[model samples]
Target: MKELHKTSFWESLMIQKRVIGALLMREIITRYGRNNIGFLWLFVEPLLMTLLMVLMWKFFRADQVSDLNIVAFAVTGYPMMMMWRNASGRAIGSISANISLLYHRNVRVLDTIFARMLLEIAGATIAQIVLMGVLIAIRWIEMPADVFYMLLAWLLMAVFAVGLGLVICAVSVKFEFFGKLWGTLSFVMMPISGTFFFVHSLPQQVQEYALKIPMVHGTEMFRAGYFGSSAVTYENPWYLILCNLVLLLFGLAMVSKFSKGVEPQ
Candidate 1:
């Protein structure tokens, strides 16, 4: 007969942390390698995308110019959008890529998915910070109006991203085709994700419907924090919190149920 091992909750948590840390390093090395640019590409990829979008908007917007800071608008909107976008998208095939690691009992299905999500979120976050710093240094964008509020929005969005990623990762295990389609589908989500236009600027009727999307609240909250009195925003933090909790519960259950069918290969 095989013996079973028991661990206290704290012990189990510590062990999970160690396992996730190892997997994170492995992901960085395997995906990015140690060559030039290497892991830096994590942030650089999103940073460049955000920069290009900013430049394009700055140089060639077809609309009349407004007093709003375009650089800050893009910086706040795009990176926050990318965090959730890439988190769930990248989580789709994390299981297959790290299937071999499952042979080690300490590693888990959740750990692999989490490591990828963490990497994606980290890249978006770092790129945001770096880009904002540079822009502020150059006087292209003013400092954030309420750093704490912006940070709260960022944190809530991260939670939302992880919850969304878990659900998607679990679903992908059941539907291989979904894994293939998510990459393109996520891009389609960007425009409507509130990354470009402010909800306040939208028609009142359209704004109400737009607010129904969870990501919209996150972006609106973040923009409100950035623009302060200058921006009129409709953000319900508690509503977003409720949505996060629901996604997390549903996602964790889905992941656990689907993972049981996966074998160490």
Candidate 2:
């Protein structure tokens, strides 16, 4: 009989790191293949979509807004929203896509889910950075006022996205209806997500309702950082942090509950 030896926590962590790294590479290759620019599409795709939105806003809302910088507004808001959107959206298929890999001892359902969400988050982050740099170089948008605030908001948003993805993944795994309806449901969530509107713009009565949304805090926090004293923003970092914690805890519990029951099939 062979006796089992347990690895130290550090050792176990390293092993999981290696496993996740391999999964990330596998995902990139599987999604993009070895064709032209392959993984580069990760960022390029978001950049293009964001560019299109920026152009559309420039074309349509030219005279509609005299106070705000429409170009900067679109540039900052859309990509951040897309990060969470893509992260949560891609999480649905992760378990099924890598179902075969689950037979391995090192691979986990959470690992597969994390890998996919991390990829989307990385792509959106890179696209946001690159687009901002280019736009600033061309004088299309000014540099952010508070870089620390901007960075913090991005970090919070990323975590929020992962939490949401975990919950969405768990729900989709448990119920077929959620998996099928997530696409439509996500669209309905977009407008209210603080993507296009500001907390200040909404009426006093509705502002409280808007603040109830964690996504709004993230968006508002990000814009506050970029727009600085020029714009009036109501962002409570503590509230967003609280929401993230609750969501993350609930999501982890749900995923763990469902994953144990998920055999190879």
Candidate 3:
């Protein structure tokens, strides 16, 4: 009996893996289409946005928040912000968008959310790497001080984005108005997200309040890794992890409960 149960568990896991893979492929095709530049848009979209921001800052000769490279600063910060926005934005109303897929016995609400999240995260990560490489090759920015820590910070930021995405997805499904409200509210989050500036650049009290936002901690930590000792970060990795965990758990519970209540269209 025990052996049979274990075998069934592994088989179930494999099925889910395949299902998610299929869903990912389908999502890409649906969003990007079959043209030559179709899939390229995944990375290109974010890359162009980052490039525009970098050029804008460069043209303006924006005063450095720190002594960090302005190009590198924009490269790191904008893509990370896009990861959060893209993931959550795509996740919102994902179920309704892919409602037909729900007819399949193997498909689940979480699977749709995961597929979208994976696509957004993958695109953002690829854009960041390509942008950084180009900048370095052109001598526009120095190599990151700690490659491992830089990657770790990026990973943590991705996790937070995914958690927040899941929550947004579930909530939007429950309340239709949430989708529009969140779209407008996300813009408000940008200035405070530690994207355009560092937390330490703010006044002491404001810095304390800013660190409470998980994305700020992730951004500051990412800069700290990239710029080495010169970077000033008020990050608590543990706190960010805890917040992700709570959001993830709550999101999963909500999705599981509310998904069953969704009426087929």
Q: Per-residue lDDT tens digits of candidate 1, residues 159-223?
A: 99999999988878888898888889888989998998888889988988999999999999999
**Lowest-lDDT window of 10 residues in candidate 1?**
1-10
Give the worst 10-residue stretch by lDDT in candidate 3.
62-71
RMSD, each candidate, Å? 3.2, 2.9, 1.4
Deviation in Å, model 1, residue 239 alpha carbon? 1.1
Candidate that beats the other on lDDT, 2 or 3, i.e. the better one: 2
Ranking by lDDT: 2, 1, 3
Instruction: Kindly list the per-residue Cα lDDT of model 3 for residues 1-265, writing each as its tens digit.
Output: 9999999999999999999999888888998999889988889998899889988987787745446678778877888999998898889877888888888889988898999999999999999999999989999889998999889889988888888998898888878899989988899999889998888788987887888888998888888888888777778889888988998899888888988887656
**Once model 3 is optimally superposed onto the true structure by TM-score, how far is the C-alpha of residue 189 displaced, in angstroms?**
0.3
Looking at model 1, residue 152 earns an lDDT score of 96
Give the Å error, residue 201, model 1. 1.1
Scanning candidate 2 in windows of ten residues, the lowest lDDT window is 1-10
lDDT of 2 by residue, 9-32 (tens): 667889999999999999999998
Instruction: Tell me how many clashing residue pairs each candidate has.
Output: 0, 0, 0
Residue 51 in candidate 2 has what lDDT? 94
Tell me the TM-score of each prediction against the true structure. Answer: 0.94, 0.95, 0.96
Model 3 ranges off by over 4 Å: 63-66
Candidate order by TM-score, highest to lowest?
3, 2, 1
